[model samples]
Target: MIGSPITPQGVIERKRGIGKVEVEVKNMQSDKDREEDMDRLSDLPDFVLLHIMKFMSMKHAVQTCVLSKRWKELWKRLTNLALHSSDFADLAHFSKFLSWVLSNRDSSISLHSLDLRRKGCIDHELLDMIMGYAVSHDVQQLAIEVNLNVKFGFKLHPSIFSCKSLTFLKLSIWAVPWMTELPSSLPLPALKSLHLEHVTLTAGEGDCAEPFSTCHVLNTLVLDRCNLHHGAKFLCICNSNLSSLTIGSTTQETPYKFVLSTPNLRSLSVMRDPIHQLSACDLSFLEQVNIDVEAYFNAHFQRTHLALISLLQVLADYVKTMILSSSTLKILNGLSTSGSMITQIPCFVQLKSLKLKMKSSSSISDEGVSRIVEYLLKKCPLAKVDVINCRE
Candidate 1:
């Protein structure tokens, strides 16, 4: 046997044996690399991978399946889901996709944020169902933008108002006939920031009292283009912890007096709304005030001018920064230079910076502008006055 000559059959079999051994070795190496990739892909932990997937669109997350078997089902456990109806061609497909995603996603994983921007007309029931599901699972940041031109929006469900986990809430509506039912008692214990735009508050004579009175931790509040209820006597905000407030309720039909009692408010802005009356209490900590009153007071500038000056007189001593419209200064200048009775400009003891926001087509003469500046320099000798034309 030792000296037997090798035949063709034996040679062929020997060559095939070598090839099989080589293939087995290569296969073992490939299996080891795949195992490592499945476990420690780029040294990233599973939670890190999931955090990355949360930022990606659902479709892109699903496509990560092609990467490897480990990533096949990772998208189903994403913690953040931001969906918009505008991305879909029609309602049917959009509904189908959202339904599938919500139903198939892992139920145990709590949602961190859910941003749903619906531009099309949608059923209120569907919205409630989505919101209900989110609130039940401890959603932290919720932003619902329902900018519909149709007349089909309903009052928000109570669960949304009393959610204990929401930290940031923004609700924006365009022309939708939205009847906002502000819960007389909102239990947003964890809410820190709230923003509402173009929303209509329901009619209630003190019926909507203490809407945000329970929000102990709220710091920033914004209301833009919000129409007050006919019976709403006063929009009172008495948050001791509040720091910034921006009110832009310019609607004239329903005039509700603004009664703010924020002791810690630092920056305050009131624009657009020719607010009928304002009563602010304990603003000893206020540092900035920006008031832009255009159409409402311009109708009867004489009366409104005197009223604005009175309000400024009370705030001129405390505020460090003031951003007022040019028209306001012109009116104030009128009051100061009139021959009948020269009104006194309040001394801005603490005012350090003055910014005048005007239109490009400002009709106020250079002399008029100089008079206001000279008046400010005379009163606040150390103040820096600047002009800014904010017209496009």
Candidate 2:
């Protein structure tokens, strides 16, 4: 009976004592005093504050003004403004938010990059307004990816082609009017890199002018999933300084054709198109050629394979390194009339290295692989041949 410290009443008394202590601590500070203390604690330096704001979207950063008077104006001075409306309920609301942000942006804006990937279709007027803002701020990089459905037929503003300070530009549109053509003359002298995805390159009405030929300093060009319809000729109008070119998913029946007149082109990668025949003008200066042709197994596949072999025969004489990955290697294995024809691989005499990616069940037996190796050894005695199973 030493004070019965373990009793239930003793436990209740200890709990009451803790509650009273917490109440006393809470009563020492009023709401106004706590808010003032928080305000003083949040007074970050300008550079530190800008860095923090950079992690937030323009809309959320702007909304912080409701937090306090000091934060209300801090977002206005941010040099970088990125507006993304991916979570908005509709395009109208997203557009209204963008309008509000643009209206309140500082006049002495240091904005250098603007990336807008809104989920809904944006009208041309709204796009033009954003482009105008980007130009006024001397934006150096602009990337816009829009999923414009076929029903809407959205078009980009022509004024966007004139941003003089833009060095890198990437544009992807799902559906657009065939009548909407690229600007005939790109005035962006500083544009060095360009990527076009799902863009239609139609020959404009009247004498079609090559829009990209004026990009004298352009060094990289990539075309993916582009539809060159209505007899549009894929021409290399500019890019004399181009060093890398990638052409992927061209229409097989559209007879897509283009010339690579760039004498400095170092690498060329082409992927999966039946139009495998390259004209004399294409890749004349290429030092390395990587061809990944999707073989259509049928009468069409046979014909296409022969055409591609002819193309390889042409490239074998000039290309220092050749890489081939596709079902075409299986077709080549079937080309040997007899085992003695192994010496025919010499057509690629200039090849210093040859990489052949074959499928495990690609109709290429161990014997067939050995035969092809012998043929290659005869043609390029000093060449190194590496075979890899692509399926793995």
Give the Cα error of residue 23 in candidate 2, in Å.
14
The model with the greatest lDDT is: 1
Task: Score residue 61 of candidate 2 by CA lDDT.
Answer: 82
Clashes of each: 1, 2
Off by over 4 Å in 2: 1-71, 74-85, 118-120, 149-155, 176-179, 202-209, 229-231, 274-276, 280-285, 295-307, 327-346, 356-378, 385-392
Q: Which 10-residue span in candidate 1 carries the lowest summed lDDT?
A: 201-210
Tell me the tens digit of each residue's lDDT in model 1 across 274-316.
Answer: 4456677777899898877654545566545555665666676
lDDT of each: 0.75, 0.69
Candidate 2 minimal-lDDT segment of 10 residues: 337-346
Give the runs in model 1 whose Cα sits over 4 Å from its true position: 1-43, 62-67, 148-153, 202-208, 296-314, 325-347, 357-365, 376-378, 388-391
Error of 1 at 285 (Å): 0.3
Q: How far off is residue 232 in model 2, in Å?
A: 4.0
lDDT of 2 at 185: 62
